[model samples]
Target: MTASLLDRLMDLETAVSYTTPPPEGERPFTYQAGDLPILISAPHATVHQRRQREKGEEEFTGALAQLLAETTGVHTLYSCYRSMDDPNWDRVSPYKTTLQEIVQSRGIRFVLDLHGMSNRHRFGLALGTMNGRSCPHFEPLILQTVKEQFQQTSQGTAKSYEELRWNHFVLNHARFTGGVANYTVTRFAAEQLGVPALQIELCSSARVVERRPLSQWRAPFRGQPDAIHQAVILLQSLVAVLQAAI
Candidate 1:
């Protein structure tokens, strides 16, 4: 089962090269349309440039986003090549522009912007709602859904919630408050598009099964398969509950 999951992740990340651009005329991001009214975005899935500095790719975020879309039938967008600009940081970017198009055209009611964080942090998952300004109406429901999902045992895994070590899930964390001070994708989707949005920052241990071969800049490490399984189930549950609510 772990091997199958890894193979799926590898297929999703095959085009994600930090140093390479997609063939000429192709966009840097891939958008998968789904029947649901929700949109899942991973803007920093590939290496991105912010103010002339290059930021490393958020490993496995793209794969997770794609997997969520596949499993939940929700709209998905993720960067698949070196980004000329930071979609989550810049005030203006092609990524944001495309997102606006998607939301408007697809009648999207909610947006979930996925990101990656270092494992050094105490929390396994950090949810940011721009201090309750982004998803004001759905904050309580969203929080409740995440907490409940994380507490349940993951399918196909015998490990209990405590054994998975994913009990730490925080909201509006001081370090990751949904880019309230910056031009984040969540902020753009909420403020500009008038859509409820949340920024979900997952620790490396919770999101990645293994770093892709192209991402050699990151340290060598493998995430526990059980933790990855639980994270996937949690996100799937969150999407299902949110879809039903909205």
Candidate 2:
């Protein structure tokens, strides 16, 4: 293991119980911090285990999250869905049961879920939740950070969410459509569980095409690296915000 991985764990509340269990032949283990007030979870990670896949969006963000981790002294993150699992369409397997068990066992405060959209509309980080269910003012701060970062990266010329049009139809629909658990995790994790939650959707064009005007992700995050990096930055930045929340 790398030394930085060790550094990722210090005051963390110790994670346990993944959404799925791995069999005897898994390559390795990918874990996250469960109970910290700031929980950065990426639901579009991959299958790292034979029967289980554990990872999050903040793992790779051009080393920005790593820098934040060191500067902020943070330790905890989560991922429940593989790139193939699109909770937006329907919630097939909600780790909510597992998350509930963890939250009840550990008492987590906030849940920040990382995701990306292919809707041809969204552009920056989103603070979508179960509708006025969480920190209502979350979007403003998230937008501020994202816009600031956009200016810093020299990555894209896309303005903040305000400058673009947003399809807000999927704001608080916790109940899955067609049994596919797309936004179910965030909805349940925050609304049902009473845990303040945030869902961030990154665009796929920047990651897949590596060009301007990121295309909205239609399916799942099958091949998107840039989106993952952006997710990481958002997660780490949110962590800092949580540190202030407490």
Candidate 3:
């Protein structure tokens, strides 16, 4: 019997889930070694706690990282289980400690942290570069490439999204910009690791084509083909931009 690609990704996630907490003293993030200088990460793919409240999963970021690794042959890291600490928010998150080690050991030059956002936002995507402090040299290239990709991919899609093209690029907006006072994962990578990093926030519309209600955030929805397809296009677009930067 043969299993499909989606099945393989699911199996991978399940296997990672089992070893999430580790035996006693193991790292929280699973690091997959790759030859490329890029390290793709999905830190919010699972349920996590932040300031005493339980946060919902981003839905498909784990699968996106896996697919990017399989397709681009790049290193990937992701949180496997419900995190005891918010890796992106907590300044002392253990995930950051291990991330520093990985960056040093693997000589990673770039960190691409993937995240998902609510569809209530105007744009389908948002790039956070900590106000050009993260990746000053490559930020413009990243922005240009992403816009081009979206325009190209949306040729056959809906036209109601025209507003997105005009107001899509939110440069260092107030929300999730990784700017000052924000000790996010990408910020740590840029400052401590000395590597350029960008936080890519994807809208739910681009992934699952629906703004999932908060009440249903915990439910598993990995088998959705449309969501997976959208993720692939976005991943490929980012890969192209990274390759150019390299």
Whose lDDT is greatest here?
1
Once fitted onto the true fold, the runs of candidate 3 whose alpha carbons sit more than 4 angstroms away are 1-27, 159-169, 208-228
- Candidate 3 C-alpha lDDT tens digits along 97-145: 8888888988888899888887667766678888899999988788777
Q: Model 1: residues >4 Å from true position, as ranges? A: 1-3, 153-165
- Alpha carbon RMSD to native, model 3: 4.3
- What does candidate 1's lDDT look like per residue over 81-175, in tens digits? 88999999999999999999999999999999999987777668899999999999889998888867765643435554344456578899998
Error of 3 at 4 (Å): 7.2
Report the error of model 2 at residue 27, Å: 14
lDDT of 3 at 149: 63
Clashing pairs for predicted structure model 3, backbone only: none
Which digits, one per residue and each the tens of the lDDT, describe model 2 over residues 1-246?
323332332112122122334345431223344324554454443322222333332222212222344455543334422332333223344444555665666667766655444535444334465455555656557556666665554445433323332212234334312112334556766656777666665444322223212212223333233333444455567687666775
Window of ten residues with lowest summed lDDT in model 2? 9-18
User: How many residue pairs in model 1 have overlapping backbones?
Assistant: 0
